[model samples]
Target: MIEIQNRAGVERARVTGRVVGNMLQALRTRCRVGTNLLEIDEWARLMILEAGARSCYVDYAPGFGRGPFGHVICTAVNDAVLHGRPRDLRLADGDLLTLDLAVIVDGIAADAAISFIVGAVRDPEDMRMIETTERALAAAIEIAAPGARLGDLSHAIGEVLAGAGYPINLEFGGHGIGSTMHQGPHVANDGRPGRGYRLRPGLLLALEPWVMADTDRLVTDPDDGWTLRSATGCRTAHTEHTIAITETGAEILTLPGR
Candidate 1:
């Protein structure tokens, strides 16, 4: 389902995007060496209610995941990457954490993710992996404009990750988002340019670039059946932003103050 938001829809998306951005930013600040994953989920729940918004993930039951992801946010630590359901685990020093969030406000929706190191222990390898994803996300957003194809964005992201010697995974990537958490027009992290759907005004896309330090393979957590971990158990990072295609270019709706 590819949704093209009208002006009013875009405005609503902005509101939802800001809420998501603020929540993520706040969570990043509150995260510490001993902070529990459940506590982070509680903080997300409170923030959503306080903002008068709804979590897209709380009742989300997609075919790829176990039915009904009963959490407000995804807290991925170390080896975990996508769809990381919160658990009773405390963060540790030098742990790489990824927080992915999506919410709805005024009937519109937006999604975003951020990866960072917890505590004061910053491993060089972890910082490089996190920074690589951030750079790849920025590259994709820079090329996201009217008339640009989805492949263009994917290619932009792939160039950065691939150039940094990281393998690309296709099983999970970005997607169109509006009025719901996930939508159609799957955006892979790597692809050929001049192919796939063309960008246009009002189209919203969540562009995310994630990579494991050593491999492209992913394995689902057997215990919870939701969290996706790296096959090699290597450190990983992910970065994302929801952008709305505009008349001349794309506008990043998930920025904190935009």
Candidate 2:
């Protein structure tokens, strides 16, 4: 279902977006060398409770996933990318970590993700992957204005990833988000321009661009039933932001301090 926020709803959405963004920033700062994935999840839980907000992922159970997510945040390290379920593993120096979070405040939901390297080691390939996704995400957002075709956003994202020499994966991408975590208008990472849904004022979309280093294929972890890893075990990166369409242009709701 696609949800359009009214004026009051938009105000609540801004609050939700701010909470999500702040939590993501805090998690990224706390995640360093030797940090446990479980610790990150616990921190997220504490923050959500302290803010009197709700977690969109803790009880999320889609057909694609095994069961209830049963976690407060997604902690993907190195090869892991989307739907990364928190584990007991300790992060090592130079490990690429992806933190995806969603929360609801005052009945509105916002989602966002960030990818960064742990500790002091800087791997060139990892940095390139992270930069590529962030650029792609920005490009997509730049083209996401009211009355703009969804294809325009997709094309912008695809161009960035393709030009960076990374294969685009379509199995999972962005989506419409509001009162619920996930909604209609599946925003693929790669697509033809002038196709799909058209943008309109009051519409909310979560634009995410993710890529694996060597392959577009993905393998789900059997043990946890939530983590999505690269088929080639290559490092991956993801960047996302929740945006709201306004009369003037697209407003990025999931920006920290906004």
Give the distance in Å from residue 164's predicted Cα in candidate 1 to where it truly belongs: 0.2
lDDT of 2: 0.92
Worst-scoring 10-residue span by lDDT in model 1: 119-128
- For model 2, residues 95-170, the per-residue Cα lDDT tens digits are 9999999999888889999999998757788988999999999998887888898888989999999999999999
Residue 188, candidate 2: alpha-carbon lDDT:
93
Model 2: which ten-residue window has the lowest total lDDT?
119-128
lDDT of 2 at 247: 87
Backbone clash count for every predicted candidate, in the order shown: 0, 0
Candidate 2 to truth, TM: 0.98
Per-model TM-score, in order, reads: 0.98, 0.98
TM-score of 1: 0.98
Residue 86's lDDT within candidate 2 is 94
| Candidate 2: Cα lDDT at 56 | 94
